[model samples]
Target: MANTKQAVPDTLPLLRDRIDSIDSQIQALINERAQCAQKVAEVKLAEQGGDAVVFYRPEREAQVLRRVMERNEGPLGNEEMAKIFRQIMSSCLALEKPMRIAFLGPEGTFTQQAALKHFGKSIVSAPMAAIDEVFREVESGAANYGVVPVENSTEGVVNHTLDSFRDSRLKICGEVEVRIHHHLLISPHSNADEVTHIYSHQQSLAQCRAWLDRYWPHAERVAVSSNAEAARLAAEAGKNGRAVAAIAGEVAGEMYGLMTVSANIEDRPDNTTRFLIVGNQEVPASGKDKTSLLISAKNEPGALYHLLEAFERHGVDMTRLETRPSLMSRWGYIFYIDFVGHYQEEGCQAAIAELRDRASEVKVLGSYPVAVL
Candidate 1:
């Protein structure tokens, strides 16, 4: 090597100067991007003649994140890069309007974490006590968007969230998946060996059942309204020197000043929960998308078959199919079908048209961009 490092030192001072210069450039470019975002707001207002403009378009943001990931040549992975851009987009959007997002929560819940991940920290996250309340919050204009858990890898479908869609006029604008990590947490001052009872949400208790049974079998496992609530209960009990512990996530543990006795105690290492973003506005196609539909099959033999056959005939990829008890008829069933294509697309439209001719009722819940990050 011809003394490759002789000219410039790889010293801290030199690196600091280079990082400072890079930071300045990044700051300048971010401000320029913000200016462009502001101009976008102006253009929309001018074009619509001051009508209500949806500043936060789910499809648009999804497309932007997808592009960011695609172009990333990172030492940092694509998700890490996309997360950086997500915050930038969040800040720029805040210049136009700060979104009020609602989630089934009491702060520190996974649903709240998903909401923040989807909308970024600039949003106003309202904690609703129930799934229906989250839907109502967005529907009543109390919140710009609502996030509710739809299904989990370990537990299965969230029936309450599914049933809410049956009657709500609100549309599914987007979907977010959250990796669930359950921990056996206790207050710092509490004695782990003295733990007498464990608390968590029912689903959480189920997810961590094997682990808890293995290590904490002697402790009484109690199911509460939510893991965050369990954390609070554990903290309260711990302060009084009672033998209580909670099974929750890092968010809850941090919130309650708890220390983890066991980490990632979930039975399934890759346990994840999928949440839906419910909003008033209908999202347009964003290249890669998914469509959700609620249908009532005619009470006849092969009624459901004909409805499903249309999707196959039209070459639409059906992703998920769920059945809920139909209120229209006790013996009847409401079908919740999710497919991999925008409802407005030719194939999806053709399938739906065939479905309308076959089923007693067909309702397009929404067509939204698929999750990118």
Candidate 2:
């Protein structure tokens, strides 16, 4: 046993040395790649002119991440490997030009997290107070892109986001899915046992309905503008000697300097939220892509059926279908649809043409690469 222990200790130093050597090589290669990215930027500037340069390509980035996953063969999982590559790509892209992303937030919100997750931490994030502001930021060229919550697995769709698309010319450039794990947080100055009021976003309150009912039925549930706002309110209340707790995610809790009283208190274990990246330009096909469209059928019988029949005939898989009231006319409905395949493809083009003929109006929001990371 002593000999075996001695052998293990001796091998550790050699293994660490090899790892250090590999790390040095990796660092050198990364810098070399960064230099290449800088050169690419110079070439693009010379060709496209300074004012019109676009450094980030959503389609290309998605393709690269997908290729990384496809070719990965390692002890590390595919997603773990892709994340490492994601940072590397993000750093390289920063060398070209840092991306500015707008998201719905007061900072420390899940939309902010989704923005970082989709665009990487290297981006400069601008927090907008409302979903429309996020869209406007991207539309007015103040931000390169915007991230907004589309739907949650437990809480259905974010109607605000759907409604924002009704008149917006901004396109869906990318998407990200983030797993949500809510935590019960108390301010550092407050006691968990003395909590009188619970604060959270209305959606979050609904998500943890059963859990809250089971554990703190007597506590007053206050719906705030956002989870981050709830955390801020809870932190302030704690300092003022009020027994208030916030239900929020880790980012908000940490940002507000609150202590976790209970972790992962969400009603469903697989709770996840989907966010969309909105930008001014339409993304080209990335091989595996999804297209979003807004269609309004004639206010008549079989209007909806005729609009959907084209996609079925073309074998285009429709992933999501949502109905929202049309702002153009009272009592009229518009269909927000998402389907697999890019608009540039033959199958999708044919399907869309048929829909345009059958429906009153058909607008292609965007065709973007599916989420890779």
Candidate 3:
């Protein structure tokens, strides 16, 4: 047989030329996509005929990310590949209208990280002191949406988040899960031996309890409002020649210009936190969706059983269930439930209807597309 295979180039110059060509093509295609997004915004404005046009659609973005993952054929992992597309979509959406997002933060917290992960870095992030403030920002139209932590894989539910949902009219439009990795950080001027006080958010402190006991048992643990605040305090203390350190994530450490004394200090390596996106608009069904509900059962015998039986009878899959003290009635509790399927679906609607009949009050918080990236 005649030799027909072409020899692969081993020269660096040839590889560089190929990469440059690919970059040029990628840039051109990205601009083309941006133009299309602009056209979509124009169409939306013309149809709505007002400034109230919704440029960002959570369901559409979720579908796009999911489709990208499904069609990806790569040596790169699904998440890494999806992230590239995420930045592209974020840039294109910015050409339409830059999205403003509020998150629980002092700017370097995990909630802020989740907002960037969900919306992409091409967004205006406003940091609020508390979760309720994040909700209020979205409710008052100061921000297009808000991101707040709902649950931690290690610590269970964030009760304050559930309580905020009890009275807020905002809906859960999307969700993002971030793996939590706490690090012990010290200022550039400080060292491990000089560190006396370890500062972090209460939850973070608890998360790293065992690690602390083993490493710095005698050091005083001080709980602060947020990890970023802890980082700020540590940095400030360093400037003053005080021996202090902070337990925070990489973002906070880098943001405050602190050095990592120890990395991944959390007791549980697999600790992860789930955050929810809250907004004023309702999200349409993205083929894969989840719905959250707030239900207050009658204070009587078998009240909880009656409320749960409806989902079992309808064959709906329940994902999480949490209870919080009711503000309306003393000694009473309200249930927060999350289940698979959109509220618009027949099975979910039937289950919700049955729940309403059995419970004293039922509120469909929102149906949102499942996290894709």
Which pairs, if any, clash in model 3? none
How far off is residue 181 in model 3, in Å?
Answer: 0.6
- Our tally of clashes for model 1 stands at 0
Model 3 deviation from native, Cα RMSD in Å: 3.0
lDDT of 1 by residue, 1-373 (tens): 2332235548999877766766887899899999999999898888765537888999999999999999988789999999999999999999988899999999999999999889888998799999999999888998999999999999989999999987899999999999999999998878999998999999999999899888988999999989999999999998887868999999999999999999999999999999999998889999999999999988888878888899999999999999988988878989999999998899899999999998888999999989887
Q: Which stretches of candidate 2 lie over 4 Å from their true place?
A: 1-10
- Measured against the true structure, the TM-scores of the candidates, in listed sequence, are 0.95, 0.96, 0.96
Number of the predicted model whose TM-score against the real structure is largest: 3
**Candidate 2: tens digits of C-alpha lDDT, residues 221-338:** 9999999999999999999988799999999999999999999999999999999999878788898999999998788888899888999999999999999988778878999999
Q: How big is the positional error of residue 217 in model 2, measured in Å on the Cα after superposition?
A: 1.1
Candidate scoring better on TM-score of 1 and 3: 3
* Model 1: per-residue Cα lDDT at residue 321: 93
lDDT of the structure predicted as candidate 3: 0.91
List, residue by residue over 274-373, the lDDT tens digit for candidate 3: 9999998899999999999999988889999988899999999999999998877887889999999999999999999999888888999999998997
Please state the error at residue 138 of candidate 2 in Å: 1.2
